[model samples]
Target chain A: MSTIARAPEPAKASLVNDPKVRGLVYQAVLVVVVVGLVWAAATNAVENLRAAKIASGFAFLNSTSGFDIGQTLIPYSATSTYGRAFLVGLLNTLLVAAIGVVLATLLGFVLGVARLSSNWIVARVATVYVEVVRNLPLLLQLLFWYIAVLRSLPEPRASVNPGLGVFLNNRGLFVPKPIVEGHAWIVFAAVVIGIVASIAYATAASRKQTRTGEQSPVLLVALGLVIGVPALLWIVLAVVAGNPIDFDMPIKGTFNLRGGLQIFPELVALTLGLVIYTAAFIAEIVRAGILAVSKGQTEAAHALGLRSGPTLRLVVIPQAMRVIIPPLTSQYLNLTKNSSLAVVIGYPDLVQVFMGTVLNQTGQAIECVAITMAVYLTVSIATASLMNAYNSRMALIER
Target chain B: MSKRIASLALAMGLGLVGAGLGATTASAQATLANVKQKGFLQCGANTGLAGFGVPDAQGNWSGFDVDYCRAIAAAIFGDPTKVRFTPLAAKDRFTALQSGEVDVLIRNTTVTMSRDTTLGLDFPAVNYYDGQGFMVRKKLGVASAKELNGASICTQQGTTTELNLADYFRGNNLKYEVVAFATSDETFKAYDTGRCDAFTTDASGLYSERLRASAPDDHIVLPEIISKEPLGPGVRQGDPQWADLVRWTHNALLIAEEFGVTKANVDQMVKSDNPEIKRLLGAEGSYGESIGLTKDWAVRMVKGVGNYGEIFERNIGEGSRLKIKRGLNALWNKGGIQFAAPIR
Candidate 1:
C-alpha cells in the first residue's frame, strides 16, 4: 500500500506451474519406486532361496550332467558337464536356422516372381500356396509333417530305395558316407589351390575389361580354372595315389540301418516345416517389395531399348532390393526364432536340451531360464547388427 | 534437454524399483488361513494321463492322482467336491506350485533329491511306486529291455525316462537310437505308427498307453524295471502347517486301511473299541488340531474317498483298464514299500 519505489514485481515460482520442474519431480518419484522394486525382488529371491536350503549360483554349470543327448553336434557324453550340453544345443539350433534361412530365401524369391508371372496358372498356383501355408499355424504344420508324413514311411526292412545308395525308412534317410583314406588331403589341397587361382584370374580379367574395353570370356576362364584344375588333380591323385575315396553304404540289419550317414527324421521334419512356413511370409514380402517399385521405372528401361532380363537385373532389382532388404532381415530373424519350435519334433535344439531336459534335471529353474534367454538374445542381437550393416549400404544415397 | 530426459529416466527407474521391492517383501505363513478363506483348495493335476489324471467327456475329472487331490479335499472340508482342479503340463507343474497358483500338486510327479531340495517342494508320501520299462510290439520278438539294443526307442523328452534309457544302454555297452517327442501321447503315437521299435516309460504308463494302441493285445511291456520312480503329491515349502495337514491326510488313509476301515464301514469303525482305529478316526487324541484340522478329519476323508487300498483298486488296479498289479505299491505290511509314519 505504501507507494515506495515501484519496482516490477517478480513472478512467483510454483513447482506445479513450471512444466520442467514438474516432469523432473514425477520422474524422480518413478525412478525411486522402480529401483526399490528391483532391489526388493532380488533380496526376496535370495532370502527365499536361502530359506529353502536350495543352492544358488552358477556352480552347476561344471557339474556332471549324467545324461545322454540323442543328437549332438559337439562331442558330448553322459560324463560331460551341463556346459557341454548347452554348446551342443546351441550348435544344433544355429545349424538348422542357417539352413532354413538359405532354403527359405531361395524358395521365397522364386515363388514371389511366380506370383507376378505372365502365365495366369503360375500366378494362381503361387497365390494358393502362399495363402494356404501362411494361414496354417506353424505348430500344427510341424506336427503333421512329423507324425503324418515321416512316420508313415515304410519300416526298415521295407525301406524305399530310390537308387544311388540312398535309403529311406521310418528311422531316417541314410546316404552313402564318403570315407576318404590316405592321400585325400592332397586332393583337398588341390581344390583349395584351384579356388584361389580362379579368384585371381577373375580379378585380372575384370581389370582388363574395365581398362581396355576388351571383353574377355572371364566366366569361362574362371570356370576352367576352378573345375578343370580340380578335375585334373583328382585324376592324378586317383591314378598315382591309389583311388582312396571309399563309399560306405548302409546295410539293412534286422531292426535298423547300419554303417552310413543317417539324417534323422526329426531334422528333416523340422527343417521342412520351418522352410515352408517362413517362405510363404518371405514370398509375400518379396512380392510387395517388387511391386513397390513404380511401373514408370520398368517403362523407362523398356524405352531405352533394354531387354527384359537386362532391365530386371540392371534397373528394377537394385531398386527393389532397397525396399526388400530391411524386411528380409526381419524375416531371417523370425525364422531363427521359429527354429525353437524344433523341441516339438524332438530335434534337440537349444530349448529342448537346455530348457527342457537340463532344467528339469537340475531343477535350477532361474539359472537355466536365464542362460537360455541370454543365448537367444545374443543370437538375435548379432543377427540384427549384421543385417543393419547390410541395410545401411543398400539405403538410398541423397546428394 | 537430453540431460533432463536422462535424469527423468533415472528417477523413473528408481520409482519402479520401489514398487517391485514392495511386492516381493510380502512374505507370510498363511496358506492354511488362505485356503480356509478361499473355501476351496486349489489342486494341480496332470493335463491328461489315462489311469492317473484324465477328464471325462463331460469334463468330470477322475484318476489316481485326481482321487488323491479329492482325498485332501475330503480331509479339509468333509466334502470331496470342495476342490478346484488345475490341469498342468509336465513342464509347468512345478511352476504352478511355486507361484501359489495351486495349493497342492498331485500330478504323478516323482520325488527326487534335486526336485525336493532345489525346487522348494515337499513330497511327504509316495503314493505310487513306479518303475521305468519298455513296451514293444509282440512281433518285435523282444522279451526283455536288454534285447532292445540297436532299437530306435520312442520316449518323451524332458523326463527322467530319457535319462534312464541312455544310462541303461551305455551301461550295457549297447548302441541305440532315441526318437523323443515333447509329449507322452506323441511318443506313444510314434511307436504305434511303427516309427520306433520300442516305447519306453513308466510301467504303469506303458500299460495305460498300450490300451490306446490300435491293437491293445499286440503290445507287451518288457519285464525289466530300470529305475525307481516314487511318484507323490508335491506341496510348496515354507508352509509347515499346510505340509503337516497333507502328510497326516495321506497317513490317515494308510492307517485306515491298516485298521481295515472301508468307506462303507467308516461310520461304524469310528465307534470301534480299538484305540488305534479310534486315534486314526480322530476320536482319541488332538492330532487333527495340531495340523489345524477338525477332529473328524480322518473320518471325513475315509468316509468320502475310502482307504489307500480302495483308492488304488478303484483307479489303477484290477478294477480299472490299466490293470497294474500293486506289487511295489502295496502297504509295507502287505510285502511292499508304502510306509506311512504315525500321525502322533
Candidate 2:
C-alpha cells in the first residue's frame, strides 16, 4: 500500500524537450533581479547623499585626529594623523587576537584531552566546563567577568598578593615584568637556526619513511637539532663575545607595583573570557574529530603488533586530522572576529579605538567606517587564504 | 578535521561578509525626512545619570538632558511625548547616532570641531559647559588637583576623560596610570574599590556620580578643570531647515534664561516693552514664518520648559543632590558662556 501511494510520477518532459527556453527564462530572471536591485539602491543612495551634502572620499583619514587615544600602542597625541591612529587600532586588534589565540589553544587542548581521561572526576569536570561555558553568550561572559569578578576585588594598595609579589586587585593583575636588553640577538638567532634545522630533519625523515618503510630517527634527531644547537650557540656566542644579560625586575613603589608591565583589568578580563569561551567550542570539535576515527581501526592497529602510543602517532591521528583541521580553522577565525567584543571591556581594540572613538571625535563617519570595514574584510580574507593552504596540505592523496 | 573544517570555514567566510554588509547598510545613507516622519524620535541619551538623564521611581525619565529631548520633540510636534530614548554606553553612543538608529543625539555629547565635520553630525548650540576634574576621598588629604599628580586615575574608557587625564598630567610633568573601564559604573567601582587614587570626569558628572556613592561626603571634587567640554545636542547633517529648528530651539531656551523668564511667566512676558522679548515672543514679527514655524514657537518652548537655567536649577542645581553651581554655564551677562545668537 505504501509503495503504491509513493509510486514515481511521470517525468516532466516539457523542460527536457525545451531546455534552451528553460535556461533562458532562468537567466533572464537572475539578470533582472541583479540589475533591478542595484539600480534601486544606487538611486536611493545618490538622492540621500545629495540631500545631506556629505562628501564621500578618503581625505578625512589623513586629517588630524585632534583627539587622543588613552592607551595607544605607539606614540600619538592630538596632532597625529588619522592614518596613524587607524594603525594604532589595527595593532591593538592584532595584539588581542594573538594573545587570545595562544591562550585558547592551550586551554582547549588541555581540556579536550582531559575530557577523554580515565579519571572520572577530571573528565566530569572537563565535561561540565565545556557544557556550561559553550552554551553561554561570549559577550555576556565578558561583561560578567569584567563587572562581577574583576570589580569585586579589593583596592589597589590593599592588593591581594598571591605569591612571589604578584599582586591582584580591582585595579588589575600585576606581575613582574622582564626588561629585555639589546644583547639578546645572538641567542634569538641561534633559536631560529635550530627551528629551521629541525624542520629540515623532519622532512627528510618523513620522506625516508615513505620510501623505505624503515622509520628514521626523526623525533630524536629533530629534538636534538632544536635544543642542542640553540644551547651550543648560546654558549659559544655568550662566552666568546663576553655578552652580558641584565636582570631588571619590578620595584615596589609607594603607590603601585611599578616598573613591571601591568595587565589592566580590562585586558585580563577580555583575554580570560575569550579563552574560556573559545576553548569550550574547540573541545566539542576536538571530540567529534577524534571520534570520527573508527574503533575497528584502533583494533586493527593492535592486531598488527602496535602499542597504543605508536598506533595513535602512526595510524589514528593522521586519519583523524582530516576531520579536525576544517572545524579548527573555523574556530580560529571566529575567535579572531569575536575579539572585537574587547570594546565592552574597554580593551582599546581596533573597532573600539578607531572606528568608535575616533569616528565620534572627527565626524568623518564615511571614511572612518569604510577604513574599519576594509581592515576587517582584509584580515578575514587573508586568514581564509592561509586556512585553505593548511586544509589542502592535510588532504588525503587519492589514486 | 581538515575537510569539514574547510567547509565550515567557507560558511563562516560568508557569514562575516553578511555581517559587514549589515553594519554598513543600517546608517549608510539615512535621510533627514525619514527620522521626522517616523514619529518616534530616536534620541540618544544616558540610561541613569542622576540629574542628567535618570529614571524616576515611577520609571519615567527626568533630568536636564531628558528635558532637552522633550524640547526637540515639542518643536517637531506640538506634543512633547513623541520621544523614544536610547540609553547608550560611551563607546556605542555615537555609533548608534551615526547608524541612523537615533534621530538626534541629546546625550551629554561635547561639541568639537572634529565631531562637527568628521562625525557626520551638527551641533546647533551648547546646552552646558563641562570640564574634566578629579574626585578623591576627602580623607586622602588631596585638596587641590595638583596633589593628584602621582595618583592613579579611574576613568571610563572610550571617552575624552582619559585623554584629558593624560593632558593634565603631562602638561604638569606628573605621572599616572589610568585604570579604565568601558562604562561609567565600572569606573566608579574601580575608584570605590580602591583600584585608583582618584576618579575623574566632567565636573558635572562627578557631582552626580558622587551622590550615588556608598558615602557621598567621603569624596571631594577638586577645583581645577582640565578640558573644555561644551556639552550640546546633535542632529545628523543635511537638512538645514531641521538643523535650524534644533539650533534655535536650544537658543530659545538660552534666550529665555537670559530674559529672566520662567515657564509660568512666559505668557505674561509675551506682553512686555522690550522689543527683543516682544519680537522673540512673536507679537509683531515673522521670525517663525521664514524658518517654517509659527510665530508662537518660541513661546511654546519657553512656556513648556522655561529655559536652560530653569532646567539646570530644577534638575541639578544648588537645590538638588548634586549641589552644582552655575559656573561656566551661566549666561554671558552673568559672566559665563551661555550666550545665544540674538532672538531678533
Candidate 3:
C-alpha cells in the first residue's frame, strides 16, 4: 500500500485492460467497420452502375413520368416530370397524414375518457375496441377497410344518393362544390373582421374577469359576432350583389357524376383505415396519461367545491398532457409512416408514386429510393422537433 | 417497419455489388460455361403470370415462359428437370438477370430500346408478339378502343400498359380516368367489380385475364391493338456466347416448327435426309457446339419441350383455356412476324 514505485503506476492498466481505453478501442473498431461497409457499398453501387451504363444521378428527376397515378392531390399527368410527380406524392401523403392526425386525436381523446367512465358498458366497450383494433395489423385493417367496406359500395350507375347533392358509389363520393364569385371577397372580409373582433372581446372579457371578478358571457358574444357577421355579409352580398355563392352541383350522368368535387374512394379508404387504426393506440396513450395524474388532484378539486366537469377539464387534462406529449408525438409519427400502406390500396402516397411508379419507369432505383428515404427522414425529423418543442414547453418545472 | 425497409435497401445495395462482381466474373467466361459448372440452369420468370410463369399448387412451375426455361435446360443437359426457376417481379427482373441471379429471364417482358441499351441486358429474340388492348364489358358496346371516350380504365400500376394507355388516349383526344392497381389480379378485380368501365393490358394478357373474370362471356376484348409490345427473353449484356446460345435456343424451337419436327415425330425426323432438317437436328454438322452446347442440343430441346408452335398452343394458344389466336405470333410464312434466322 505504501510502496514508493506503486508497481510503476500498475503498468498503466495495460491499455487493453483499462476500461476507458478498451471502450474507446471498441468504439473505434465499430466506427471503422461501419465506415468500411458503407464505403464498400457505395463503391459497389457506383462501379455496378457504371459497368451497366445505367446513369447514376438525380438528373432523372427531370425526366417525364409516363405513368399515371390513380389519385393525386395536386395536378399530375403522364407528361409531368418525375419532380412534379414526387411533389404530388409528397403533398398527398401530407394531406392524408394531417387529416388522419386530427381525426385520430379527437376520436382517441373521446374513447380514452369513455374507457375511464363510471358507466360499465361504455368502459367495457371502449376497452374491447382498444384491445381488438390495436391487436390487428395495420395493413390487414387497411385491406379490410378498403376491400370489405369501401369497395363493396354500390356501383356508379346504381349509386346511393346520400342526399344534399352527394352521391356515394364505388368510384368515389361526389359532392357539390361552392363556386364563389363576385361579392365573395366581401363575405371573406367580414369573416376576417369578425374573427379579429371576437379575439379582442375574448381577451378583454378574460382580463376583466381576472381583475374585477365579473363573469362575462364571452363565448356567446364571440360566437354571435363571428357567425352573425359572416351570415349578415353573405345575405347582403346575395341580395345586393346578385348571389355570390353558386354551388356547382354534381350532375349524375349515365356512367359518372361530373361537374363537382370527386373524392376518390382511395382517399376515403386510406383515411378511414388510418383513423381507425391509429386512434386505438392513441386512445391507450391518452388513457395512460389520464390515469398517471394522481387521485389527490381530483379530491383536492372536489374539496374546493368544484364540479366534476370543471375539476376534470381545469385540472386533469392540463396535467395529463405533460405525460402524454412525448408518446403522443411518437403515435403521430407512426400514423404518418403507416400511411405508406397506401401503396397497397393504390392511394398514391409518397412511397407509392415516387418510390414505386417513378422508380419503375425511370429505372433509377438508387436515386429514387434515396430521395424517398430522404423525404421520410425529413418528415420524421420535422415532426419530432415540432413535438419536442411542445414537449419542452409542457415539461414540469421544479424550484 | 423502417428496419425492414432498411434491410431491403441493404439487400438492394448488395445486389448492385453482386452485379458489379457478376459483370467482372461473367465477362471473362461464357455464362454457358458457368451453367455447365453449376450443373443446372437458373432461369428468372414472372412472379405469377397466368399461362406464362405461374406455379401450380405443388409449387411446380408450368407455363409458356416456364417451358422455355425447361427447353434451355434440355438443350444443355438433355434433361429438362435440370432447370430451376426464380420468380421475379416486374421491378426486379432486370436486376435479377444483371446480377447473375438467373441465367436467363423469360418473364414476358417487353423489349424496348432503353431496356436493350440501358439495364445492362440483351434481348436475344421476340417470343411473343403482343400489343396493348382494351377489354370492356359486352354491354358497353365498345367495339373499338377509339369509341371508348370518357372511359375509366383499370390497369396495373408501373407497367408498360399504363404509359400505352395514356399515349393512346392522348393521341385519340379522349378524356379518361385510369384506375391503377398494384397487380393485374387487382386490376381485374376492380374491373370485375364495376369500379372501372374497361381493363387494359397486353392483348394476350387480356385474353388470359378475361378467363378469370366473374363472367368471362360478358367481357369482350376490343379489336384495336394500340401499341406494339414485342415480348422476349433477356440475358446479361456482357456474355456474347451466352447471348448466342439463348438466341439460338429460341431460334431452334422456331426452326424446328418450320421443319415440321414435332416432339412426337422428332426421333423419326432426326433420321431424315433433308439437308435443312439434318443440319438443324445435329445430323449434318456441329452447329450447336459453336454456341457452347453438345451436338444434339437442338434434338434435346425439341424432344423435351416441343417446337415453338407446339409450346405456344399448349400454353397460350388455341389448345389452352385462353384460346388466344396466333395473329402476330404466327410464323412469317404464315402471315405473322415470327421469323427466325437460319441455323446454319
The per-prediction tally of clashing pairs is 26, 17, 0
Better of 1 and 2 by lDDT: 1
Error of model 2, residue A26, in angstroms = 8.9
Q: Candidate 1 residues A145-187, lDDT tens each?
A: 9886665788888999999889999888999999988887776
Per-candidate TM equals: 0.91, 0.81, 0.91
- Candidate with the greatest lDDT versus the true structure: 3
Error of 3 at B225 (Å): 1.1
Model 3 chain B: ten consecutive residues of lowest lDDT: B19-28
Q: After superposition, how far is residue B253 of candidate 2 from its true place, in Å?
A: 3.2
What does candidate 2's lDDT look like per residue over A152-173, in tens digits?
Answer: 8876567788776577776567
- Give model 2's docking category: acceptable
lDDT of each: 0.83, 0.74, 0.84
| Model 3: docking quality category | acceptable
Candidate 3 interface RMSD value:
4.2
Winner on TM-score between 2 and 3 is 3
lDDT of 2 by residue, B185-279 (tens): 76786677666778998889999999878898898889898899989888777556767877888887888788877788988898988888887
For candidate 3, the per-residue lDDT at B8 reads 53
TM-score of chain A of each: 0.87, 0.79, 0.89
Per-residue lDDT of A242-324 in model 3, one digit per residue for the tens?
A: 88888999886645777678888778889999999889988998899999999999999999999999988989888999988
> Each candidate: RMSD to true structure?
5.5, 6.8, 4.7
